[model samples]
Target: MKTKRMNPFKPTAGGEPPLLIGRNRVIRDFEKGLDNGVGAPGRIMLITGARGTGKTVMLTVLGDKARERGWEVLEETASSGLCERLVSELRTKEGLMDKLTIRPSVSFAGASVSLGEAELSPKRMPETLRKAMAARLDILEKRSSGLLISIDEAQAASMEDMIAIATAIQHQIRERRNIAIIFAGLPQMVSDLYNDEVITFLRRARLNVLSDVSLDEVRNAFSQTFADSQMTISDSQISVAADVTKGYPYMIQLVGYYIWDAADIRDSWVVTDEDVKNGIDEAHYDLDNAVCIPELQGLSKTDREYLEAMSQSDGPSATAEVARRMGKSAQYAATYRKRLLDAYVIRETERGEVDFAVPFLREYLRKKS
Candidate 1:
């Protein structure tokens, strides 16, 4: 029996793909920002995209980069009470903050500190957060290091938390502190943040809108990754497989994962076109369930109808045609259209036309009808 190979591709969320495609520019600029000292525009990063576009992964990779440069990386999710959480994370840094406040000769032998997860009033949260964060940066400043804060799922983050984070970063910037923050959210939500007067700092930050990786990059990565795994796949076969993904970030991993699965089950190291076909079938099933299903969640009936109507078109659906299919006026339909666009479910194509943003979404919608 031949030795089995572990799959090189990862399809699950939070699993760092062995190969990162199409983000070299971001990585390069951010590392430069670390070296450029405080107030580099690259240090204030905003990553936005539709779901499955790897926004969270971008934060993780950047956090690793920051750690490599001796910066303390604080990772948090933008949920309710996020500012409160930030305070807790800062205080509980294993005496990292305490060391900065106390003298070097000071020793705490069996000294106990009572720091509970006390709820903070919204009005005072911002100030408290600023002080705590500044203390940490003060220490980093001494060592010529810095701090990098990453917040994911920022769309759901509270306005209060947003205000607090912005206020802290603004103070640090004014003081010329070596502080950086990365916010990852949906495009619509992040846009709203930028529009706010309090969060104007975000407008000046580096924006990374996640989208499809280039086909050439995806194809090359696919070939090299498989080759490194000791799997035999030709350049032509790789190109065909890469085309199937159309360069969507998550789809890249899903399709590659399934292709490897198909090849592995055959007990042959050589990947075949048939394997690609089988993989696409499996990948589509997963994509529909994983992506389409969640995307449809909480959509009103009219929203569902709008998507179903778009499915009737062979390509991009004319806005008027979609409205006609739904038996609604175009003016009435435009509301839902904007909603979908903001949510990244559908995007404007040519003038007066819209198309599904999610890959295989048309098939998924049609199947439901």
Candidate 2:
């Protein structure tokens, strides 16, 4: 039978390719925790990575899985007034009774709220929010078995608000065995969480740090995605595409999108090496003009210096090394490291090595250096 053509190169709302790879183990671990009571001592999981590393997508997938297991899910973003918006969303007239489903108890609210006649700002009342969150989870436990709260872009949240949120989770939520919280953000999220006095308690929560996609997985993902669309491409072409992207999820989609479009124009069902090359060139040009340039404009002088130094280094440098290179003190270099992390400009590897979080950013920094 003839197959239908589907585009494999479009960016989904969750910022992930339709096919996700190298995450089965992580997903299973989370599922096990939720199924077995959030682990022996109880824990939350933090998934951190660089920008465009599929952190958001991982959260969404996990949220979906949690729902299938009958856990209540609450999702919030870390924009401006997230806390106030969450309280208002949860405290509606219908309240917790209306948000539960067989799938999972799910609720969503923003950081801003519109009162009957005015807009209210987000606040940092840790104690109050703690109580409220506990109450909501209690209701979910009665209806479903447990509750899972997922927060995206958590690093973007205000430091004070993060502390308040962390306080509530550590103090109020920790007392209950029926709730779990999952936070996903950039690598700097760890620093932000550590700033809170209650962070030691928070650290008891589990941590899941995402990494880059593997070359083999990237090839299979792209090949399968296109195959499902009734298109055939040689392995060599797929490898070239993967090489150009370095297995970055966002770049994978960008390259695939253009290649599929090119094939459609020529009425060809097969993608060739030449097609892949052209697609990559197009993606690089577009990214340079759009995303890369704008991000460069946002960097401060210190950010640029740290990025250049790290790009030239073999691995993550200690505070002393970074400071010595810049003729500054270790303490001063540490501050710049935090800033770079907060800005999603750099990330730490498992071996305590640090490097540019985004490959395109590294390329851009190399050019400037």
Candidate 3:
């Protein structure tokens, strides 16, 4: 007899893993905010992080928590017609606001005929989203429940749509209606939104930066996740796997996924150090092909060169030193520094030093160069 094997790790972007490590505090705080009622600060929050940092997963967890609190959760992308779509969603649900009516007609022969059920329409359906949302919130308020709007990849959302959504939310807040909006996106998107005067309300929204997990956290996640599936991996194996993953959320899953598959579950049902080593290689290959290339393709030539210069360093590179290495003036480097930081390809470790935000990005750059 052979045992069936199942991989517990999810490495795909935005995919929720079986266990989400290093984000408990934020999740707890958001839930507490919801319990505090309509004006809770955490109710309107923005999550910012580099790619592979689990921003989307955090949003998913938060939305789940909101639903548990009896809130209607609507997941949306910031695309063309976003506001119109949001307005349409509210208008579509207008039926819930009005009472259902069944009108009976009396015939000349004295027999009564009943028409099929129909919703009682309001005297005027609001033409604007702000008005429609207000009307909809009025109905939802009566039910003592709230609405949670979660936006993912918020950077791609149009400015006009962003304003409309924010305006509607602001109105709901002033009216004391229960509503919450959470947004998740890259670090640059968060910065741009904060800079937009039209949507300054987001500046006050709770901003949470999704940071890397600790090696210890990664180790525990790997060990416990594997054990949950009725398999045991040696401590050495887990340590190697975690170190290879460098505590980035996506890499943690990628490393675990590949390692789990390499373990020969049907035969040995154990993950050895060799399996971990091989899995690391496979994971890195996949990451380069899937994530790194696409991310780099989106950047400007200066961005790539700036990163290439930084890759020469063994550890966190000083901003001034990188500028010198690139044979450019400090001001030129500073410009690109901010650009890369905003793009999330690199992060500042100290006041004047930066390192690749994503695990293994430096290595990938080095190999490509």
Candidate 4:
């Protein structure tokens, strides 16, 4: 029997993907805050998840919704030098802040304003940036009903900047009642944000952590995708594919892509269990060859050993255990932990347990070891 061809299921750049299942609750929460007024203390939203868990997608959706509601939105990526760029951008746009009734205390002229002029000349650039931001927000309070700033990959932002931004938003801007900030990034983002001794921004902001999709949701989403293409697949087939992927968004799409293409090659009208099995195998191979191989090429021997040890374990190891296994002291293991986390090799759960954030990563590590 020939199989029916299916549609592609990869992420659509610059557009919403079909079968974007789940995340309704998060959308609603953001909408509720906007409706009630974002200027209320403790109204900001922070979305964190592993890479490819759709943090970017959620942020884009929220930005679209906010724009539809007549709110001014500024989207930027978190980076070491983002604060300076932001100040430069703000200064270049004449009366940009004026539209929202925000007036800059100091203006950028021929070159970007020095972090000093804005009363931000602290030891940390982020601190300086925060003061400058507060000054501008003070002006915005007069013009706009509210302002929303959306930042992606916010964990990359400097500790000083994170603290500065959080402090300004929580203490300085919250009083004015006209601004909201949303930060989205990998799971470590919250830890980085909280590391600032001066501010408890993570505590004050609402957390919206994206998790793996449920089996039922995954089945429905897959079935819906096929149905949208005027094709059909068996429930058992969908369930099997979901199990293989554990409902990770990227894996789901990867497997779906193979299944659809396989059906096209067979000229079949319906997907079967066998096709799902083949697709799962193909997806695993593709991930190993495309993602894992390239990342492994750059790792040092110690890094590889650390990853192997982590993969064999179920959760975060005790500092002492990891140190003993790696033949290093607890202090040395802690350093490796930070390096791995920074490279996205591992993640810490809410309860402080560490693990391979992506299931596929464990498989890759096992094969390598």
Candidate 5:
């Protein structure tokens, strides 16, 4: 039997999986918008999720889909200086207009001597950033190719740059110019962005909040991915793997990756239940260190304390209960609650109830506390 060449699973955050388990509707809507061209609702999209919820991967999918439809895709993070970077990209494309050159030559004794070269005059780019973007769009418009701008880590982008991009896109939309902008970020940051007065227009953009995937989708992905990778496992084993992931996109990949490696270690062509059992511990450790720890480290002392209190609950905890355990006033606890909710560290299941959104986070916190 031929050994499988390598592990097919990609467990790292932001890495594309062999099979995207969920998000079918998102992909379909985006494609429909691209087909409709300007003024389509899908053209302007905001993807919000927690850190490991595949926001970046979704942006990648959006860009890939646009490119497949013969559109120009420009991807960038919404970091500081986004406006300047976009302006620079537009200027570069503007320079491409003067690519042709002509050399004046004189023939003497059957030999041609070049005197000087006259090049195509460069087009003047607009001084303003918005106008410069418009000028670039005009060029693409002539060719019947639309532009798709995708921004990842959008929460980090400065308000000024966000406004510039929003205004430029608004101008293009008003003109019916073919352009679209997609943004992905953490839920709280995205909410903050939408609440900003300068980019109020983005309030109308289509919002996609990525949540836990369905178990059926996860199971199907595991079966198909493993079969393709030349590994076989029982349906029960697949179920175990899926349940282990708790429907988190990143955890699904992590469990699959480690399980595959476990099979490899045993020199077995087929994956067994024992391999999966061993892999779970390893996957859990890696997930905590890679995702959970760093997330906690970024929080304030009070926020961490709030989470530690919440961890005592088996399921969703009441805000009042958590406050009582922390020995703080209800208002004081409310502040940290809101902070954690905004940060996507916890989610509200119903009125007065909150729970850890990150799978297995409660267990990790319990051990730490």
Candidate 6:
């Protein structure tokens, strides 16, 4: 018989967990940019990380802070229609549509419009979008506020939409308007997608490569969250639970969720060692399904082979050892290493040593093999 108590942990992708761990620096920097006003370097930022590393949650956190300081935030997921989505939001802001009296000469209704009138030719999209965004910015300027446009999954966004957005932002930059944009994606694809000359401004934007929290951060988060729920667990139990999470945000939340659930199922408020143990067991499969499976699914046979060979080592595997195990030359191994590094599936530890960036990936890979 389980209690009807609410679970404090959120394990879903992009979902804000009960408490954000070790993210004050990034959040504060973005705020410092907003506080400093126009043309601040941190105003334009690019965030890159492996899956479940809280990239989206950081976007959400930044959006909340901007709103608190009276800045309008346009949080969007990158896709083919990114420009269209951004333009749509800019066009429909209250009291804004009435101000943009149309030019009356409407040719084609696609992605180009003479301000506030949606739909026009692709060739004219950047122009119409710029004008609409300018109108919105003008209103914000009067209020001493600013605009922040954040795009997630930027790797998947089409180049055309990206260019259109870049062009509009470029115009605002030239005019020195108070505006900011953040783009988040897997580390591997960020450089290729943002390296185009047209969006060269992005090249100069601050780059933040997000990773995991320290074990101490995880320990404190677990202690605080559990204490808030009015549950009592010894420091040793908390340490055991925190160590099991290994500082991965997804597992942190997932393990905490099950720990709470384990207590709920026992119809008790006190969390026992058994509860923490059970939570770790249950969280492992859910983590694998949520993160590891999708990541492994994207690997090629060679990539899988490289990972499998690397999994033989308990810790970070040396590139030479991994290559020798595969009966291939180090040169052959270097290619897959770069691919995996770019994909953010594996990260270089020290010198030529590499380890799985995805948590519990070694156990999962070994189990599969």
Candidate with top lDDT is: 6
Clashing pairs in 3: none
lDDT of each: 0.85, 0.70, 0.80, 0.70, 0.83, 0.86
Superposition error at 9 for model 2 (Å) = 3.7
Residue ranges of candidate 2 with Cα displaced over 4 Å: 1-4, 10-13, 38-43, 93-124, 171-174, 289-291, 301-342, 347-354, 365-369
Model 1, CA-based lDDT: 0.85
User: Which regions of candidate 5 fall more than 4 Å away from where they truly are?
Assistant: 96-127
- Give per-residue CA lDDT, model 3, range 1-369, as digits (tens): 547666788888778898889988888779978999878899999998888888888888898898887788878877776765666677668763321232555565786654312111211212266676776777777888788889999988877677767777887788778888899988878878888887788788988888889999998888899889877799888888888877788888888898888876436677777787888999998888877887788788888889999999989999999999889999998999998887778888999999987757788899988
Please give, for residues 190-295, the per-residue lDDT of candidate 5 as tens digits: 6687688867888888899998899999999999998988888889999999998989988988899999999998888788878999888889999999889987
- Residues 126-244 of candidate 2 have per-residue lDDT tens digits of 65567567767667667766767788998888876776677777665447557777888877787678666756666776677777789889888888888888778888888888888
The TM-score of predicted model 5 comes to 0.88
Clashing residue pairs found in predicted model 5: none
TM-score to native of every candidate shown: 0.90, 0.77, 0.85, 0.76, 0.88, 0.88
Error of 1 at 260 (Å): 1.3
Per-residue alpha-carbon lDDT of candidate 1 for residues 1-369, written as tens digits (9 for 90 to 100): 569988999888857788889988888888988888777889988888878888888888999999988899999988877887787778776354442234234235766543322225677677878888888777777887888899998888988889988998899889988888998988877778977888876788888888888899999999889989888988888888899888988999998999988989999888898998999889888998899899999999999999999999989999999999999999999999999998889988899999988767888888889
Pairs with steric clashes in candidate 6: 110-119, 110-120, 111-120, 112-120
Q: Rank the candidates by TM-score, best first.
A: 1, 5, 6, 3, 2, 4
- Candidate 4 weakest ten by summed lDDT: 94-103
What would you estimate as the lDDT of candidate 3?
Answer: 0.80
Worst 10 residues of 1 by lDDT: 98-107
The regions of model 3 sitting more than 4 angstroms off are: 95-127, 264-266
**Model 4 spans > 4 angstroms off:** 1-8, 12-15, 40-42, 92-145, 264-269, 272-278, 289-298, 312-344, 347-354
Using TM-score as the measure, the top candidate is: 1
Higher-ranked by TM-score: 1 or 4: 1
Model 1: CA > 4 A from native: 94-119
